[model samples]
Target: MSSTRVSGVVVTPVAFADPPLLNVVGVHQPYALRAIVQVQTDSGSVGLGETYADDAHLARLAAVADVLPGLDVYDLNGLRQRVSDVLRLDGSAQVGGMLAIQNPADVVLSPFEVALLDIQGRELGRPVADLLGGAVRTEVPFSAYLFYKWAAHPDREPDAWGAALDPDAIVTQARRMVEEYGFTAIKLKGGVFAPDEEIEAVKALAAAFPGHKLRIDPNGAWTPATSVRVAKELAGVIEYLEDPTPGIEGMAQVAGETDIPLATNMCVIAFDHLKPAVLADAVQVVLSDHHYWGGLQRSRLLAGICETFGLGLSMHSNSHLGISLAAMTHLAAATPNLTYACDTHYPWKTEDLIKPGALDFFDGSIRLPTNPGLGVELDEDALGRLHEQYLACGIRSRDDTSYMQTVQPDFTRNTSRW
Candidate 1:
């Protein structure tokens, strides 16, 4: 192992423009928050990480950064303990709604873990995937993430994506995404409209792209009965039904009744969540997110557990830029059991902090970077500009339900609304 010590860590909170994509929670705000982490090593290498930049998360990250200097890059467990000891819970712990599986400490530790791994890779002169037991596959596949959206926010002008509220509009949107990015699979974000309307949209997607894999995630907006009904209706067409209902119990109920395999990034979110979910046979597939699962190494562990449990494995995504994408690509390339194409929100965002030619996709797959570390450099100017935007933009937290209130005055969050 290379004995590289971290010299310093810089945490920059940034905000970037986001499209008005609608989901079960609410519309995507004009600006989304993220923290860019840079870990400088004694060996003269800098490793990078990116994650949520909400006020609460940023506070934990800041605390961790304060103590990161002189820490060994290879001592991940020590890093975790250091972060756990430093973290003090505040209201920021409740960002993505109150899921029982959510852990604030994990949120703070994940990005730093990634940053350290990046440094380790650079010090050893190998790719991150090589450190994770080498690449099982050179190309990582990603699905086109489709959302039901308005032309724009209530008062703002429509962005280039336009409105995709109806079946025809959604079909058009998918066509554009596949044509531009060469995505072979599609995942539609549901739970915004009634189940029947969303079902029709999935049917339209199936008809438009015959033989292509398709999925619908409602973020658990339906009851078990409603979830089962939708699953049966689109039984043969969809590859898997994702988060049709909420929680392990609800998912298990729906799974018991439907042949369409159930998948989730919601119910089985953490490592401890695995046993109960597996025992109940609640989820047939687990959508792994490195940000929430701790980091790429932990994600590999999650994949191994899924394989041992006879469950399908795929990656999850939130709104993010190229750094996270590069980390995801390296992790996916190294994971042998990741059978399905991963989900990504990269196509939706118009702006990014990485250099212009950093990442690309062809035929739905990202060719793994051969260079040392993550193989993507941060664009200092873009980073500075986005940081300025974060300073000016006043979105301190992401409350999708509250944001939706502006568009639909009577909007209330009900998981079983349908």
Candidate 2:
């Protein structure tokens, strides 16, 4: 039924400007890395994909690309097999941070899978959402993903988002983001301060925007006791508590004590983790990241599993640019069970690799990109600039703790330190 074949593939690693967004691991690096994937087909159509650009992951992508040239775009099964065969138990390290799984095959397969889907959509003259079943909603809403931060990275000029190290400053940051993006929901990246202090910040956000839905993720910094204490303290103030502590047993312990539903991109990261998590009643909500879940189709499968298990579904994000945003928008638009506003770091970045006007936020939602394929194009000049930024930035991979130590000499990365 199909004639076009993959003619070639290009994986370009790029780094974009980032601010001092603090979290559980430490503060973000000055530059965030991503690999832009372009899958060119024999019929003269090109498809785009984006993913994490760690050195090991880049090597995996390059290995897959070697075998991709002659494969059929429709044969995503074949593509996945090639990735698995190449990466067979070699590099299954956790990517980016604590919430990730040790599945290099899926992490490696993600971008290439997205690119192939883009090619399929382009060949069929349909948006990627249609390939994923079809859009259940015309517009996809995203929450204001707020972070506790310094006004600037060390030794750099202050960025537009000023320091948000306390309750008042956090409230100020939330207000500015909501005002600019029209986001009706907000999530604070916590674990940077003491438990009560962070609780105070949540109360401040609640007071500032009484109409908005609120949530916080400490990235598993607290013990079960502290998690329950915060849950009871903010019982009606917040919608859900996310990753307050690590692992299923601890999460189940906290869930047992609180009525506020527990959510995570941590414990339930992989398919095998699902059964144990369900058995322990660890997580109520699972934040799906296609980048680590083996891309869109498998993400839909993940949604189905969550629905069947009576678990809520939402999307997770990383510090990324327009291409990742476009892919996320299409996937969210098509998934019926993804009811909550997805999380995004789109507002935090000062730069992007794709040309503008294809995606924009209105009332905190991006309307479905109806053009063929991913509905976004690479700005050649911008791509080159970001690639150069990648080269000269002198950072090979993301090491938030190491970067943070350059400023905070005694910085410790213990997850349950509190």
Candidate 3:
């Protein structure tokens, strides 16, 4: 066996403070859930990966961790096979429904694949970007991802950002994000309000912050007709309109009617979705989330496919901490076609599980961390603290629709409500 042979794996579930960020699904939970994966190798290297901490996902992760020992770090294909074997026996069941993905193997395999990539980079004394390919850009730009949120969760004191229920509040949130993070591109999370209301919010953002690239994702809340109307109105104002409607056929309908490029994280997820999406000319941009796309190298393969089909590539995010951020920055740096500023929810959080000073943000982008193996040191104390919070938080899985229903009993998720 190689020195990079796996020794053990530790999967720790953690919870961190999350504001009530509203979206198509529902409001963000009181604390965002994530599983921190540490893959320890025989050579004394530990690589970190972050992923959704839904109870089912955590169970799958634990199962894989049990079988990871003795597998070589560089044997990514073998790793996938092992993950596939374990998951097949467990029976394929989706962890959650916030996003649609055809392959559960991709979901279960992602974090372990990322951890192995980290181990490989550490062993070779190179950045993950170098391993992907040499860095195409030293720093990666990220968009200010604005959400329509409440002042606070029910029965809780107002958090810092306050309530953003209207156009003015959205613009105010944009101002804060751009001012503090220096983000040049801005995106709004739509599908929570009426189409016209969301359109007005985008208009207000355009007036408030001229020259900033803007886009809105409605998460398939509107029908094709409504999506077309909104897209036409915001044609010149938005850089692109994301997931305005659902399904490849639905997106194709919207695409046929508008000049504005359509993008999606919903309909066009997974490798198998690529051919059908391209054939329909349904979307122009595909947002890559490594957590769902099977980690860094496989995500690179996705980039190549997007390039071949002449599609714009952008990265997607969840409520993540620094380890995921570091991995994202490195991947984006190496990806040539990922020219669009990627989306991030980083500025919304006040706490992190990584040690300070591993990454920096000043001008709408993050400079790559130069240290080996993802370049961010895990904070053991912080991990323990967050793990404690997770146990006390009592949220085993995310149920945003139910969470939103608690706040507004009448609330329900609608794919084409408008």
**Residue-by-residue lDDT tens digits, candidate 2, 222-303:** 9999899999999999988999999999999999999899999988889999999999998999999999999999999999
lDDT (10s digit) by residue, model 3, range 1-418: 3467999999999999999988887788899888999999888999999988988788889998999999989899999999888887534445444775555788888888888888888888998899999799998999999999999999999999999999999999899999988999999999998999999999999999999999999889999999999988998999999999989999999999999999888887789899999999999999998888888888999999999999999998888898899989999999999999998888988889999998889799999988887999999999999999999999988878889999889988867899
Question: Could you give candidate 1's per-residue lDDT for residues 169-194 as a string of tens digits?
Answer: 99999999999999999999999899
Q: Model 3 Cα RMSD, Å?
A: 1.3
> For this target, which candidate reaches the highest TM-score against the unseen true structure?
2
Cα lDDT of model 1 overall? 0.89
Query: What value does the lDDT take at residue 307 in candidate 2?
Result: 95
Candidate 1 vs candidate 3, TM-score winner? 3
After superposition, which runs of candidate 3 have C-alpha atoms over 4 Å from their true positions?
Answer: 89-97
Q: How much lDDT does each candidate structure score?
A: 0.89, 0.90, 0.90
- Give the poorly placed runs of model 2, Cα more than 4 Å off: none
Which residue pairs in candidate 2 collide?
A: none
Look at candidate 2 and tell me the lDDT of residue 193: 93
